[model samples]
Each structure stands twice: as structure tokens, then as C-alpha cells.
Target: MRAAALKWVLWDVKDTLLKVRFSVGEQYCREAERMGLSLNPVAVNSAFRQAYKSYSSRYPNYGIGQGLNGHSWWTAVVKDTFSLCGVQDSALLQTLSNSLYHNFCNAQNWEVFNDSKKVLEGCSSLGLKLGVVSNFDNRLETILKSCDLLSHFSFLITSEQAGVAKPSLLIFEQALQKCGVSAAQVAHVGDHYINDYLSSRTLGIHGFLLDRDNKYDRSEVVPKGHRLNSLEELPSRLQQPMD
Candidate 1:
């Protein structure tokens, strides 16, 4: 049977279209060395990655259960990451973590994915409504604009604006509302299996998983969705009708 054509393309920004560099990691490691604490860049990077995942997964629940704000949620994880790394100075770690705000705010600290602009242009030319559903702070618009991709999206919904993150139907729903499309008519593309694929699928939105790192095994049955290694592949995927 023929499938429905996709009318809207929803996206996840960080790690999907943008590569976020943790400037705080290098800054913190330098501070740790100055304080005579041993810190490995690889170890810190690994710990920070795990900490970010844990925070993203746990914070929404924390917001629901304990009424903790997102900033506090993230701060707690940053503190824990430093503590677990055996950094004894709480004040220094706090200072370094706070420094991350600078990196995130500065456009120079991030690089737009190699294929992001091309995919965006192709989708826009195809007349598909483009929107961003990202777990981000208020600086999301500025970041996108800095990369000259802000004009490509008709709707830009961020966690700070939506009061919820991806994997939460509210975020996707709000984006769809802005685009004036139903969940079933839109398709979301992102990197994470859970946040992008499972979450969107549960809401009846089609999912396209991007395996940028080639970490997922192709032989393993990809869940009922399209999978690609880069945004460069998105145009062709979009050319196909949605199921």
C-alpha cells in the first residue's frame, strides 16, 4: 500500500544538526590541574556525556515529581560529575560549570553539522514545513540564527519555551500546533533512539533515526522507521511517502 507523504519535518537540534563542544570541560580540567587534582580529558568527557544523559532522562521526572527547575536539575548533575571525578573543591567546580553558559552562548563554540544547511535547504525547497523541537534554553534562537538556519524553520519550540523537553508529547504537540499539522502528518528526525524515535512514535508521529556515529548495527531490525547516517540523507528519505 502507498503511504502518506510527510508535510512537516520536525528536528532535534543538538547532536542532530549541531555539534556541541564542551568548553567547560577544558576549563574545568585546567582548574583541576591548578588545584593539584588529576583529571583526564577523556574521563571527564565520558563522565560529562553520561551525566548529560542521566540529567535529561531524570530532570523531566524531577520537574514533575519534586518541582525542581531545569537549571537546578542541570547544576546538580554538573556537581555530581565533578564530585565523582574526585575534584575536592566545590567552589572551583561550581565556577567551571557556570563557565559553560559562556560556551553555550557563544556561536564560535559550536559547529553546525556538515550537512545541516543542505538538508534544510532541500526540505524547504520541497515545501515541507520545518520546525525545531529541542531540549534547550532561551539561547536556541540565537544559536540557530548564528548558523543562518533559523529562517529555514517555521516553528522553533524549545524546552525553555514549551516547559517540557523532547520525549514529552507536549513539546512535539506545541511544534505541530505552530506548524498547523497533526502528529501523524509530521515526521521528526533526531539522533537519540529514545527521545527522537520512541517518543515521536508513541505520539503517532513518524520517526527518522540518524546514526551519525554508525554505532547502531544495521543488521539489527531498525524499529518501524527510516534510519540514516547523516542529514545529507534526509532529502531522499523525505522524498518517500510516510507510512
Candidate 2:
């Protein structure tokens, strides 16, 4: 029998191996009903998402100027979103923001991708070392364990734990060190172009983009790595040599 030649495979969790359902808006709306706010949960969810994006993008500039970390930035965004939704209770909004930590930890509503377990199992059978590098809070390990996928990974690196987020080479270097593989022998699979593709390429490690949104089809941003639509396509993609 031939042994697997690949040294390591690194994966991203959210929107890559798992489908995250944001239920905080629904919970907030339900609580709002008790407080007589009467806002639609869907609208709240959309507004929250937009606010989050705006805040996240602005943070590197405005946040550092204000000396805020990632958690503080997101908390402010959540409070702003709730305020925009006509939520007037300061205490309730604080509780809602705190609730995110609980939701992420439990993740009872989040689901592993349909092909995630199968793909990981296949990789294990092939004797490939597996790891995860994610931009998440402290609950990433609990989330993966809840889905029964933790055992497949030899290393799990989260931005919260690493004190650095994706699109940063430091976190990627940490994953490589833990897996004991050179950049050339490692493949990093993730769903975001900037975080997953550009960052890995900067370090000379192979990067694969999971473009489920088809947003890149019209863009001229040719990735330095393979592009795949699903986790099921990973094994075949990995089997091919790097170009």
C-alpha cells in the first residue's frame, strides 16, 4: 500500500466545513416582543450583518485609533444594530451581545457541511495530517467537537487563541509549525479570498478558495491557488499537483 505524500491539510470552519446559522437576531426579536419592540427578525438579522461588516472593515483603522480589540469592535456594532432596530433597553442589548458567546459555544443550530465529515474521513484514511485555522472566538474547539469533527484535526488554531486573525501570516505560520510541514507541502482551504487565498499565497503555501457565492466569477482576481465549490471536491483537488 502507498502512503499519502501530502504533509498537511488545513481547513477553515465557518462557511467552509460548517454552515453557521445566526440565530441571535431571532432570539433578540423574541425578547423584543416581550419588551414591545415589534421588529422583524429577518430585518434585524440583515441590519446586524451589514453593521458587522462595516465595523469589521473600519476596525483596523478606527478601532486601533480607539484602542479596541476585535471583541469590543463587534460588541459596539451589535449595540448599534440593536439601536437601529428600535431596541431601547441598554441592559437587554448588552445581554444580547453577551448571548453571542453562548450561542457560538453551544452552536446547537449550526450544522457541519454535508460532505465535511466524509471528506475528513477520506483524508484520514489517506494518512494526511489535518488541522484547522479559523477566525473565531474562543469557542471554536467546542463547536467542532459538538459536530464530532474535532478528532480529525491534529491541530486547531483560532484567531482568538492565536491573538491574530486570518489574512495574517502569523496564524498560518503557527498552523504550519504545529503540523511540522513546510509551506510547499501544505494546502490551506478556506471560503474567503482575502483571508484564505491571498494570505496563504503571501507565505508560499498552497491556497484553495471555496467560492460558494460565485462572487469571484466576474472578478479578475485570479487566485494563486485552486478554486473549489464544495468540500466534496477537495480530495480530487488535492490529488492534483500544484501548478
Candidate 1 lDDT score at position 151: 94
Q: What's the true lDDT of residue 39 in model 2?
A: 81
Q: Each model's TM-score?
A: 0.78, 0.82
Best by TM-score: 2
RMSD of each: 3.6, 3.8
What is the alpha-carbon lDDT of model 2 when measured against the actual structure?
0.77
Clashes of each: 0, 0
Superposed Cα deviation of residue 30, candidate 2 (Å): 4.0
Assess the local accuracy of residue 86 in candidate 1 as a C-alpha lDDT between 0 and 100. Answer: 74
Error of 1 at 128 (Å): 1.3
Model 2 segments beyond 4 Å from truth? 1-4, 22-24, 31-37, 58-74, 218-225
Tens digit of per-residue lDDT, candidate 1, span 28-108: 576567656678877877777778778767766335345665456666767777877876677877765665544466677
**Global lDDT scores for all candidate models:** 0.76, 0.77
